[model samples]
Target: MIIIGERINGMFRDIAKAIREENGAVIQDWARKQEERGARYLDINVGPGSTEPVRVMKWLVEETQKASDLPLCLDSTNYDAIEAGLKVCKQPAMINSVPAEAAKMERVFPMAAEYGAEVICLAMSEEGIPKDADSRVALAMELVATADAYNLSPDTLYIDPLVLPCNVAQDHGPEVMETLRQIKLISDPPPKTVVGLSNVSQGTKNRELINRVFAVMAMGNGLDAAIADACDEELMAAVATARILLNIDIYCDSYVDVFMKG
Candidate 1:
């Protein structure tokens, strides 16, 4: 499974302060640490912390690259900040999202094509988050067609089924897994499915346990990647275990160690 590190996002207090102060050391430190913790992409976001998002995004992209060459997941609703971040990114990266809405697809698809970047398409639109599996699948299918029209391969499109806080939307958990399964069956070489895994346990007591359990569950149901807290050892270990069990990784007694060290 692909791990997009969530620690660098400015939603966290430390990250928000770093972004506000343009603290390169703190930002690069998080970037390097996440890379060492087995992240495939470092998700960078200014969130509500940045008053000058475009400038801050450029700084973030450049600063994070100073420590590691890992691709970034440029996360923002601000189109100009996304563009600014992409301009400074040394590698092809992932766009944190576009939704299934027509205007966003028309815009974000072309941007993805131009930058040779992948994108996460939220399985939502003007109707908002669907409460059922079928609606998510329908939105994902539309995203696939939009991707094709832009000449962005299905592989470059990551469809996020959009997990809500499971504590509030208790019954929706299984529905999301079903959505993941349906997303893969949409086409041959299906659009990859990802989730913001931490959202599953937000505001809950057992955040790590819930995140790990839900992550492994989603992996079993054809999840391809996740934007997650890589700093959580149990969470990462669980992912490694799931990968090995699913035969995505070779088995060994030291499998977890090997996966982490690699």
Candidate 2:
């Protein structure tokens, strides 16, 4: 499974303070730590903490790269902010998202193609989040078709089924899993399926337990990647174990140690 570290976002208090204070050390440290904790990519988000999002995004990207070589997932609702970070990225990065909206796709897809970057397509559009697996899959198909139109390969496109908080949307858990399973059948290669893993347990008492269990369950339904809190050791360990059980990893007594060290 691909891990995109979600800890560098300014939504967190420490991260918001770091961004506001222009603390490169804090940002870079989180980047390095997430990479050491087994994240293949770091997600950088300025969130609502910044008044100058574009400039701050550029700074965040540069600071993150100073400590870790992992590619970034430029995450912002602000298009210019995402573009600013992309401009300074030394490696091919990913755009954290584009909803399945026509105008947004027209902008984001070409930019991704030009920068040799990947894209995450949220499985919703102007109408709103769908209530069922079939609707999510239908939106995913439209997203994949749009990416293809822009000459982006299926492998470069990630379809996010948009899992909501299970506390309120209990039935959504199984629906999202079904969406993941069906998404893989959309094409021969299939656009990868991902979810914001933390969303499953938002506001729940057993956050870590819920996250770990849900992550493993999602993998069973063909989840290929996740935006997650890599700092959660138990969650990462669970992912390693799940990978082995699924025959995606060679198991050994030290498998968890080996996976975490990566």
Candidate 3:
């Protein structure tokens, strides 16, 4: 599974203050830490707090690259900010998402193709999050059809089934799994499946346990990547164990240690 480090976003109070203060030390430190924790990509989001998001995005992208050579996932609803980060990124970055909405696709998809970047296509349209597997699949199909215009292949797209808070929707776990199962059958080469795994534990008391179990279950149902807290050793260990059990990794007694060392 591809682990996207989710710690540097401005949504967090510490990161927000660091961004506001132009704290390159904090940004670079966090970037190095995430990379050491085995993140394949670092997700950088200026979020909504930035008064000058374009400048902040540029700084964070540059600072992160200075600390680690890992590719970035530019996360924002603002296309300008995304482009700003993209401009500074050394490699083809991943756009953390474009929804199935037509206007959003028009903005993100073309830029992704133009930059030779990968895209995360949310399985939600303008009408909002679908309640069932069938509806989610419908929206994902729309994005798949649109990908053809930009010459994007299955590998260039990461399809998020839009996992909701399990606390709010009791049946969401099953619904998401069903959506994952069916998403693969729609094409000869399916879009890579990913989840913002933390969303499953939002507002819950036992967040780590819930996230670990959900990661295992989601991987079984076809999830190949996640944006998550890689700093949590226990949670990442659980994921390593699950992957080995699923035969996605070679089994060894010290597999968890080996996985983290990568």
Give me the displacement of residue 202 in model 1, in angstroms.
1.3
lDDT of all the models against the reference? 0.90, 0.92, 0.88
Clashing pairs in 2: none
Better of 1 and 3 by lDDT: 1
For candidate 1, write residues 170-244 as lDDT tens digits.
988989999999998887788999999989998999889999999999999999999998878898899999999
RMSD, each candidate, Å? 0.9, 0.9, 1.0
Task: Provide the clash count, candidate 1.
Answer: 0
Off by over 4 Å in 3: none
- Candidate 2 residue lDDT tens string, 1-262: 8799999998999989998898999998999899888999999999775789999999999999999999999999888899999999999999989999999999999999999999999999999999899999999999889889989998898899998888899988888989999999998788998889999898889999999999999998889999999989999999999999999989899999888788
What lDDT does candidate 2 reach at residue 242? Answer: 94
Put down candidate 3 lDDT per residue, 1-262, tens digits, no spaces: 7789999899998888888788888989998988887788899999775788888888889988989898999988888989999988899999989999888899998899888899989999878898999999998888998987888987788899988888999787788999998988887788888899899999999999998889889888888889999898988898888889899889988899888767
TM-scores vs. true structure, each candidate: 0.98, 0.98, 0.97
